[model samples]
Target: MKLAYIVALAAGLAAVAPASAETLLRIGYPGTGLDDRPFGYGDYIAIGHVKQLVEAEFKDQPDVKVTWTFFRGAGPALNESLAAGQLDFAAGLGDLPAIVGRSRGLATEFLASAGSHDPLYLAVPPNSSIHSVEDLRDHKVAQFRGTNLQIATDRVLEAHGLSEKNIRFVSLDSNAATAALVSGNVDASFGGSEYLDLAKHGVVKIIYSTKNDNPTLGRNSGLYVTADFEKAHPDYTAKVVEAFVKAAHFGADEANRQDVFEIWAKSGLPAESFATDFKDERLAHRLSPVVDDYIVARYKDQAERAKAYGLIKKDVDIDSWFNTKYLKQALTDQKLEHYWPTFDAKGQKLTDGEVEQTRAATN
Candidate 1:
């Protein structure tokens, strides 16, 4: 009878062990990983990393483990991991590649808009005679083909009545393009805030930027989770969103602006670079997670543009691509429902009721 009791206790212990096993939450970000610091470009996820927000969210559940992987290959490489079921969540995915991934049948749901209306600039050799976008006709222009920078470059060219056909397009990553620009290997290159440093040092000259131009020409980024993960762990997904929203709240506050700039400077760029890039731009507007009419219209337009540019083979249904349930619940749970303003499709502010109507339609 004692032996029978011992066997039964062993079985009960085995069952309880499985329940206490660790649950791994794998997250991916498309940026160069810095030792002892997460990639910080005024993004909420980066802030979350600094503050241990996600880990804090799961602190009560000791069996949960949150792991993050940074990819230097950017969105395309991150998508490959997502496709292989290696990543449960991904952030900093630009408009074009995210659309391409969805069009190719990757089962991921958009969680929230990361950053939008980020200006892109065209940089040429400091000594070069290229003074404007129109001067690049028949010249070699280095562009990163598979990223949102490609779309920004295309739109800038179109705005100047020029196309890729007008230039000899060279495919290169941002670092490579920057090197090429400094060495005069490419007549000009298009990129983001890094170019500000190059210009400051006389290595490159900024000919044009999308700051006050067509907002569509600028870049937008977002965060996403695998559909399977979201479906299987809705409560966990909610917690993740809550953590990110909490970070967003901190990132958007005016009091944290200086600290954000200082933290992001750890990515090897000077604090002045972030300040110059974000000049005259509201931090809250850039870091907002709200899926308003502007977010929907911008992504829908990106899909149509990508299709027109022959970048993607099929149309992407932007409406079904998003899972706003998590974000809505996060806002309510965090009491940040009215923290950020809503914008229309044209980037204009909307009344509170209009914002509610938009949220209602999505819900």
Candidate 2:
């Protein structure tokens, strides 16, 4: 009887083997530059790729393969692919596109915040008279629409009592915008750290930047997974989250700071650019995976701004969009729940002593 029972179990295991023989996790990102490399500035997903962390997590399962797809057209193109069921996971999706995707009925769960508080710069021709955001009025301004930067551009314009219609807006990717700026085709271009290099080379001058402006205008990035994918493969989703969190820990380590910057410099930008970008900032706070109050409030604000700018048809319920379970579980499983400090809705970090006091008071 025992032999018969063992035989039955063996047959059942064999029957299930083929069903789990193959699993595919398709992760999509916005920039095409990072496609050929394993890392990019401030990109934890790329770090995971460089470390082969995700692949190693599933190494024992020979059937699972992880594929990364990069879309040069940025968020809109990535959303199109997501709509077509071509991507199961996404990282580096900006707040605008993420909200827009949800408004358009793309069911995806926000996994964790990726890059946030990225300063933006408006680069004008080396000899141009443009001196500020207000100076760009009635001028040709290059902006990459349908991405987080678009939202930032709009906010910056509004701050200066201007709107997109007030200026001649030209939609161009980062590279094209840079070329146009240098060639005098566009009056100014809104960009990130790359613009710093242009400024250094005397090709462009930075008229305005978010260095001391409102933090909300800084573009935020997030990681997400399709609702169907999450429901169908919760285990795989959890593993992916673990891998990302592991990468984040590595990125936040002070000892690995220079190495992280070196890996990210493969995108053709100098390592010094990243160093300047992250100057005076803590990597742990910047690369935190915790879904703190600040992240929630920021997304809510971005959704509202998107509606005000006519980027979305209706309001997106930001609260319901987040699936913090994956990140929370990953932190707990990795024993890193308290490794990073938590920030308030205003982006102020609570001191460790303060956190303990708060917990004590609540208890």
Give one digit per residue, the lDDT tens place, for model 1 in 234-320.
Answer: 999999889999888888876688888887777777788878888887677677788888889989988998999999988898999
RMSD per prediction, one decimal? 5.1, 6.0
Q: How far is candidate 2 from the true structure (C-alpha RMSD, Å)?
A: 6.0
Model 2 segments more than 4 A misplaced: 1-20, 34-39, 351-363
* Structure candidate 2, residue pairs in collision: none
Displacement of residue 157 (Cα, Å) in model 2 is 1.7
For model 2, how does the per-residue alpha-carbon lDDT over 252-313 read when each residue is reduced to its tens digit? 77668898888777777777877877777666656767778878988998899899888898
The runs of at least 3 residues in candidate 1 whose Cα sits more than 4 Å from the true structure, single-residue gaps closed, are 1-19, 33-38, 351-363
- Clashes (N, CA, C under 3 Å) per candidate: 0, 0
Worst 10 residues of 2 by lDDT: 351-360
